[model samples]
Target chain A: MSKKINLTLKVWRQPDNRTSGRFEVYPAQDIDTDMSFLEMLDVVNDELEKEGKDPIAFDHDCREGICGMCGCVINGQAHGPDAATTVCQLHMRRFQDGMTLVIEPWRAKAFPIIKDLAVDRSAFDRVISAGGYISVRTGAAPDAHAVPVPKDSADQAMDAAACIGCGACVAACPNASAMLFVSAKVSQLALLPQGQPERDQRVVSMVSQMDSEGFGNCSNHYECEASCPKEISIKNIARMNRELTRAGVRS
Target chain B: MASSNRTLLQSSIVRKQIVAVTGLAMVGFLIAHLSGNFLIFAGPEAFNGYSKKLHDLGPILWVLRIGLIAALLGHVVLAIKLTGENHAARGGRYAVSNSRGDGGFCKKTMIYTGILILVFVALHLYDFTYRDKTGDPTIVEGVNGGLSLGLFGLVWNSFLQPWHSGLYILAMIILGFHLSHGIQSLFQSIGFFHDRYTPMVKKIGFALAILLAVGFISIPIYVNVVRTPHL
Candidate 1:
């Protein structure tokens, strides 16, 4: 048997950082307790539109478990206390009636407040560009078997490569450090022979750029991994440090 | 493209290693610095005398100083180089599309704060360490109990001046920002960081960073405000 639940929603609303931002509350009832979090938002938006009030604005797409766009703090946990998926993947079945939901954007110095629920995450792209890509020579594409990378190294690279570049890291970070993201970028590439040319410079340049962006240092808050929908390991950050050190030594 | 400017910046992995090691070394320096400063409670003779002893370390001190300077320079330069490369990439934020940042690691996200601390470092080196050694910081002699050589007086005077104390606090705040991320992540970067120990490490790192921030700032605050003789 399914029981419809009632709840309160206090969500941050702002047209942009320039204007005043405030939290607005609404009494929501008759919601399917088994709906995804976004589904719950959808229900609220419908109610708001019917009442002729402006519906809350939020970032989400591909209601599935991929496409790192959906975000909200259900109670306090990013993406609502689920294991390795984003908030869009979160279902209301996990919630009880009369629960209060607080939705806010990722807060950080580098991530400027963008509308009600969106943040400018360009800084991350810049960090990736710093050395995230590998240089491949043009001509006949080499056979996949030609590289001869060890299986474990390949697996490790794939694991690090799984990062979706969501700013959840910056948002979850108290100091807003970006080591995890930078490290992920570095580790994934460094593990493969194809990434050797750029590996040294990639780690060096990306790490340097990460610092210049005004982000905080990584003090190892696993909130990033905890908040990560993919559940990326904190070990990648360690790998980045190692690479940075290795890069530093030969530089 | 010929390995010109691109190559120089990208030349060696050793350079990156130097930066990381230096960063770790600086942390070690902070610990030693704190312990030595505590000698103030040891009475003026022991304290100022300790400073003199450090100076008395002589030729060996010069070598260490050179090494420290080299480390600092290497770290800073590489850091700057890396920063430029990141900016050159992507050129701007991603288009407003269906990309939700995935969940894996939240902390992989702090290159910005790490950079901010770099700026703070320049200001700090200029203000405290450099100024003190040169006596440009206003060192006085024979004021406190023994060998008052303006060391204690300089420290007390700087903190009491409000602005100096504020700057000291500001530097400490930046240091706090750096350590809060660095210490915990250092374990991660080094690879000992794990799922079971991640939470413990985070708490330990945060606590230590906060403690250092508070302790270092307390010196300037205490000397400048509460510890003022008139106060």
Candidate 2:
């Protein structure tokens, strides 16, 4: 058995990219506490549809906290007030009856609002395309033990690999700097033997792309780490800085 | 392909490296400056002799002065450029946000303190170097049978005024705030930080910042309280 609760939502309502947006309040009546946050939104949208009003638009896929599709600023926090959890995984029970939730899209130059809460995250994809892959042939898979990577390096690579590219970091950052995201990509590759072939070129290209994308500089605020669903450590940023210095000197 | 101009000019991360290195160089200069300033505690003769030695170093002194000036200029120019880009990147501000703990006070106020320190540096140079050059007869007096403005007497007289000493103390406090973040940030920017060592590095940075601030502040206070008014 689950408890029922009523709440109010101050959600951002934007029709398109060219026009300005504002917060519109909605009454969320008789919501189940056991329901997931997205399920709660589904109920609200259905109510708006029966009345012939425009439904609130948001982005989400694989609501299990992976795939990195879901993102929004819930009450000024990226992905709501939960720690190390995505917006989709957030449950309605986290809130109390009559609580007003202020929701808005991620406000960054690189991430423009597409609708109400969905922003275009293609800028992140562009950054990845710049140098986020290795140059190895795909003819056959190598033996699992052939590389013999050090255990410490393997663990660090895995840690860096945890980033889901959800853009929460950009949303949380005051400067909108992508140091955490870019550093995660650079660190994962820099720690492996396969990623070494293009290590210098990768860092140089990726960092250049990140800058051209109009992201801010990291002043070591550590906000990205706190808001990150993956909890990616900022140490990766230091590593990327080292790699860039090495690449700059070598080139 | 050779390193493009973008790597040095437009690259925000690379610009950080530039700022970090130049900032560290300035820190080195501060340490040397504080050491020389301690010479004033050895009484007027020792301080005047050290000043004369520096004055006699001629061409070497010019080289050092030019080097310091270039470093300061590079640090300031890159800081302005990077800060502008960061401001533009934010695009818009959040309606409701909180940065209680994660956003450290020193980290956010780097620009403010940095600008303040720059203003202080300009005023300080004018007060000491320019005033010395113009030879203000009252502040600059003869010592050790020589007709030159003794550096010790000039420094002593400047601190005799309450406003001058107060401003110097305030500027040092601001410098402490700037350096508290700066020294630790230098290690990260240069890629020299480690998870195990970084904590200790931060502690050292904090301690060094306080030490430098107190060291500099003591001079004005000592001159005001202990030394007799020879000016």
Candidate 3:
């Protein structure tokens, strides 16, 4: 038989960003240890649906954690108590029987709460739209060796490229700074040859857009790196700084 | 396509760089100031001589003062602006917000300690420079027949009162708190630090902060405990 546990959840619920929110406690009974965290929430939500109460609204897609869609502060952690694991990937076994979890949406001015445990992350989309893409022409597939990247640069770029755009960095920051996320996007391209033509313009535009979207500046608290599911390095922020500084000086 | 009219000042990162550079300038000033204060341990003659040399610089002294004031203004103004931006970034507070490592004390209370340091600087100038200019005979005395505060006498007399010494000591501690975080942050802000050397950098910052606090506090302690009032 599957090991089952009963838990209490203190979940934040609000109709919109303008309205005040409060914690709504729900009893989660007979939760299977093999189920993922989101699965356990699903069970509670199912019960709420049956009772004719407003079903708890949360964000989740590609429950395996790749989509960057599912996230919430589980017991003050951006993605629950597991390191480098998203909330959707966190299994029920991590929690013991009778434990209570406090769940809340990402609380940043850039990320307004849409409903219970769901925030409007369109601000991220705006930041990305500002400069996250390479402006190159479409052509036939070139040889893989045609544009050979240095091994170290490739690895570093890949490391930064792993960022899932989860907004966890912003959520985890004390100042709600989007530096880690923005830097990841900037570093991923800035390290590559394909991203060179517009590198200077990209960094400046993206960073300015980030400020326009109302994210705070990085103070090197390292909390964003700590909470990132991808383990994105705060060094990426340094790279972004170097890029921005050089671009500023040159122009 | 679109006319993007963004100046360097409009960029948040650049503003931070300005803050970092100016902050480090102030740190440099603190180190020099602390070294000068250390001359007091060599006795009043050495201390007064050091003060006399500084006072003799005349117009150059005004240049240094203006430069320091400009740095202070840049640090304080940007700090205030960045703080507002930081506050606005958080839509609201979490009910059960918790953090680990750098998120604690020094990182969190930067603005508070910074404001305290500003207050301390104001009081410090008033106690040492302004008082001397006003010809307040109680706070000034001659050294070797020269009609000046003798720097050493000014420091010693002010620290003679327990309350004055207490406040000065407290301010040094606060300055230490500010520096511990400020030093490393300035490095990171200017892109000179990384995680590989982060532990070492943090230790350096901590050591420097402790040194400043202990170094500055030693003066008041020495004045109260060891030095005899001589004019």
For every candidate, the chain B TM-score is: 0.73, 0.89, 0.89
Q: What is the C-alpha RMSD of each candidate to the true structure, in Å?
A: 9.0, 2.8, 2.3
What is the Cα-based TM-score of model 1?
A: 0.60
Candidate 3, residues A8-87: lDDT per residue as tens digits?
Answer: 99999898778999999999999999999999999999999999988788999999888899999988889988889999
Ranked by lDDT from best down, the candidates are: 3, 2, 1
* iRMSD for every model: 9.3, 2.6, 1.8
TM-score of 3: 0.95
TM-score per prediction, in order, is: 0.60, 0.93, 0.95
Question: Per-residue alpha-carbon lDDT of model 1 for A1-251, expressed as tens digits?
Answer: 66799989888787887786777899778988678888888899999999998888788878887777777555556666777878888877787888877777676667777787777878888887777887676898788787698998999899888887776766665456676777778888899988988777787677666666767655444667777777777788777767766765687
Worst 10 residues of 2 chain B by lDDT: B133-142
For residues B164-208, could you state the per-residue lDDT of candidate 1 as single tens digits?
A: 777668868877876776666556545555667888987997888
C-alpha lDDT of candidate 2 relative to the true structure = 0.86
- Segments of candidate 1 deviating more than 4 angstroms: A137-142, B1-231
Candidate achieving the largest lDDT:
3
lDDT of 2 by residue, B139-182 (tens): 43333333444667678878878999999999999999999999
Which of 2 and 3 is the better model by TM-score? 3
Candidate 3 backbone clash number: 1
Chain A TM-scores for all candidates read 0.94, 0.98, 0.98
Best by DockQ: 3
